[model samples]
Target: MGAETNGNLEFLSKIPEIKFTKLFINGEFVDSVSGKTFETIDPRTGEVIAGVAEGDKEDVDLAVKAARHAFDHGPWPRLPGTARRKILLKFADLIDEHAEELAALESIDAGKLFGWGKAVEIPGTAENVRYYAGAADKIHGETLKMSSAHQGYTLREPIGVVGHIIPWNFPSTMFLLKVSPALAAGCTMVVKPAEQTPLNALYFAHLAKLAGIPDGVLNVITGYGTTAGAAISSHMDIDKISFTGSTEVGRLILQAAATSNLKAVTLELGGKSPLIIFDDADVDQAAELALLGNLFNKGEICVAASRVFVQEGIYDQLVKKLAEKAKTWTVGDPFDPKVDKEQYDKVLSYIEHGKREGATLLTGGKPCGAKGYFIEPTVFTDVKDNMMIAKDEIFGPVMSLMKFKTVEEAIQRANATRYGLAAGVLTKDINVANTVSRSIRAGTIWINTYFAFDKDAPFGGYKMSGFGRDLGAQGLEQYLQVKSVVTPIYNSPWL
Candidate 1:
C-alpha cells in the first residue's frame, strides 16, 4: 500500500492522517505474525501519525526465510549484472519521479524540514541507487598465479540473504545505502527500521515494488529493536547484517552475529568528531563550515563535528563570530515556510543539556518561539575535553569549542574520543593539513569543508564508530564472498 492521499497538501487545513500501517514482506503489505502494531508519533508535536506493524521474532523468521529462499532459488541472484543494473536504474528513476511525495512523508514522519528533505536527502537516496546500479555491472574477479601445476581463479559471489537495520535520523538515505548495494550484488534483504521513524521505510518498500524489485527480495519489518532487531541480528539464515545506529547496539549486534551463524557484520555507529581550525585559516569560511558541519540535520548526524578545536590564535575570534551567526538561524515549526524546523528542537534539547551539564553556554541557548520542537542554535565555549558535551554524541545542534596550542595538541585532542568516524581541518598550509590528516584517526576527513559525500567515496568508521565501509567499490564488496577455484593440469601417477 502507498501513502494515503488524505494528507495531501490541499488537505493541510485538516488534521494529518495515517498514510501507511503495514509491514512489506515478499512484495506485498502484510500483518505482523503476532498481529501487534505500534504507534509512530511525530516528535515535533508528540502526536501519533500512524500505527505500524510491530514485527517480533516470528516475523523476523518469516522475513529471513523469504530472503533465504530468494537467494537460494530466485531470479534475482541468477540474473546477469547488466540485468540487475537495468532494474536498479529504473528504481532510481522512480524514486526521482515521486521525490516530492516521498519527501513530504519523510518530513511528517521524522520531523525533518520538508524543504531539506526534498532538496537533499531524497536526491541523495536516488544518487546512491544509481551509483550502485552502474557499479553492479562493473564487479570483477581476478586470476591468481599458481605455485603448483594448476590453474586458479577467484569468483566474487553474493553472500546470500542480508539483514539491514537502519536508524531514525536519516531513514530514507540509510535505507538506500544498505539496500541498493545488496540488491546490486544480487542479495535479497529484510530491513528493520527504527520504531521512532518507520513510515518512510514502508513507503520505500512500496516504491521498490513499483520499480519492479522482486517479491521476497526486499522486505520491511517494523518493531521495537529489542525484539525485531535482535531477531534479525541472531538469525541463522541471514548471511549478513548491516547496521547504522549507536555503538552500544552495534556491540550487541556483534555478539548476536557471533552467537548465531557467524554472519558478516558491518556497522556505521556513533561519533563525536572534531573540527580543527588553524590560526592562519580564514575566519569567515571556517565559521560557515563549522556551522554547517555541526548544525546540518539539526546536528542529528553521526559524523557531526561535536568537538571544535581551534588554534589559540584564532579561537576567540572564531567563537565570537560563530555565536553571532548562530543567533540569526531561524528556528520554528518544521512545516513553516520561513523556518528550518528539522533541527530546531533537537538543537534546543542539546542546549538544555549543555546547561544542565555545566557547559559554558557561549550564545544562542534558548528556543526562539512557543510552537514546535524549536531550540535556539547553541554553542558552548571553554568546554573541557572531559565534559559530557565534548565526549558524548550529542546528536543535536550543539557545538563545543575548545582551544588547542599546537598541531600536535589538536591531533591529540581530536583522536581522544572512542569514536573515529569523521574529522575536519581548516588551514591553508598544505603541509599542516597533510600532517594533521594523517595524525587524526577518523574514517573521513574534510579540509576547509564538511559533510562532503559522494557515491564513489567509501564511508564508515575506524574505532568505536564501527567497521566496514558503506559506499564506493568497497561498499559493494561488503555483500560479496570470495571463492578460489583450482584444477589439476596433469594426471598424477599416484592416482
Candidate 2:
C-alpha cells in the first residue's frame, strides 16, 4: 500500500475489528452447520478480507425456524407499534455511531468509494431506518360502513416471517430497504446477504440485537444465491421474499416461490434507464446530470441512466460537454478515502462491444491504473436504438448517447426498452416536462434532477424490471396482510 492508502487503512483500523462474520441466528453468532466458509475478496487489491460462513439449505432451515418462532411467539412481533419504533430508532442511532466502521467494511468488501460509502450510503441507510422508525406507529388499518344491515372493517396485520435476499451492489441501502419496513410491520426475518458483500449485514444484525430487537427477530445468513437464496425462496414457512438483483435471477426467485407455498415476492431488478435532454433545457445542467446519472458509484447503481437520449437541436453540444466532464471522474482504489474482476471484465467487454457495434467512442474506453478493477469513465455517441449498449444494462461507468427529433419520438425511444425502472428528463418547459413524465413507462421519473432518492418516495420498476415499491407507506404494506371482519346488526335483523 502507498503512503496515502496506508493512511486510509490506518484510519479504518482505529475502528473496532469485525467479530460477526459467522452466521447470526436467534441473536447469536454461530458457525454454519456444515462448517463451510467462503473468502471475501477486496476488489481493490484482490486480497482476502475475511472468511464468512457459507450458509446453505440446512442453515436456511434453521434461520426460517428461528424467524417463525419469533413471529409466532416472541416479544418482537407482539410489541406495540410505539415500542417497535423505539427499538428501531435506537438501532438507527447505533448505526450512526458506527458509521465509519460500516462504511469501511462496505468499501473494502464491495469496491465502493470509501468517502461516498461513509458520507452517502451509510448515512442514507441510517436515514432510511429513522424514516421507517417514525413510520412504524403511523401505520394503521381501515374502517368501513356496509349498505346492508352489517358493519365491516379491514385489518392489516404483520405477514409473519419474511425472507430478504439482498443484492451485492448497494448492500447497505438494499438491506435496509428490505429490513426496515419489515421491522415496522412487526415481522421477523431471515436475510441472505450476497456472498460478495456480507460484512455490513452481519454487523447490522449485531446492532439490531444491541438495540433490543429480540432473539430470532432477525437472522443474517451469508452464502451464494443458489443455496441459501433458493432455500429461502422455497421455504414454506416464509410468508414473503423481497429480492433486489438481476432480472434473470428475479425470474428464478419467482418460480421458486410459485412452486413452493406461493409466498409473496417483491423484486427490484435490472434497468437500462434513460436520461432525456430536450433542446429547451440548460446544456450545462443537462451535461452534469447525464454525467452523474451514469458515473455515480462508479455506475454500479441499478437505476443508472446508461441510455441517454438527447433532442436533435442540443445533441452535439450536450454530447461534447458530457465527454469533457467524463474525463474528470477518478477511478481506482475504493478506499484511498475515494473509489471487480468478473464485473471489471464485463464492463470492459461492453466498451469493446460499443466500439465494434458502430457506436462512437467519444471519450474514455479503457482500463485505468496498473492494477485493481478500474475502468476509465467512457462516453459513446451516435448510438442507435438497436445497438447492444443501448438495449442492455451495462452496469458500469459508460454512457451511450442517442438522439430523437421530436418530443413524441423521444418519449417513444425512452419507453422502448423492456426495462422501465427509471427515466430522467431535462427540460425547463413545464408542458414538455409534464407530457414526457406522464408518457414514460418507468416506475420513477426525474424531471430536472437525475437521481433524487428519498425515504418518503415510493420506488420500483415496470415490465421486466420487476414489481413492488420499496420506500414510504407502500413499502410497509408489502410486509403486511389484509383481512376483513364483519358483524351483523341484530336490531336490523341482517345476516
lDDT (CA) per prediction: 0.85, 0.89
Candidate 2 local lDDT, residue 474? 92
Among the numbered candidates, top TM-score falls to: 2
lDDT of 1 at 40: 77
Model 2 spans with C-alpha error above 4 angstroms: 1-16, 337-339, 493-495
Residues 28-116 of candidate 2 have per-residue lDDT tens digits of: 99999999999987777777788999999999999999999989989887788999999999999999998888888888888877777
Please write out the lDDT profile of model 1 over residues 292-341, one tens digit for every residue. Answer: 88778777889998899999999889988997888777765455511124
Candidate 2, number of clashes = 2
Each candidate structure's count of clashing pairs: 3, 2
C-alpha RMSD of candidate 2: 1.9
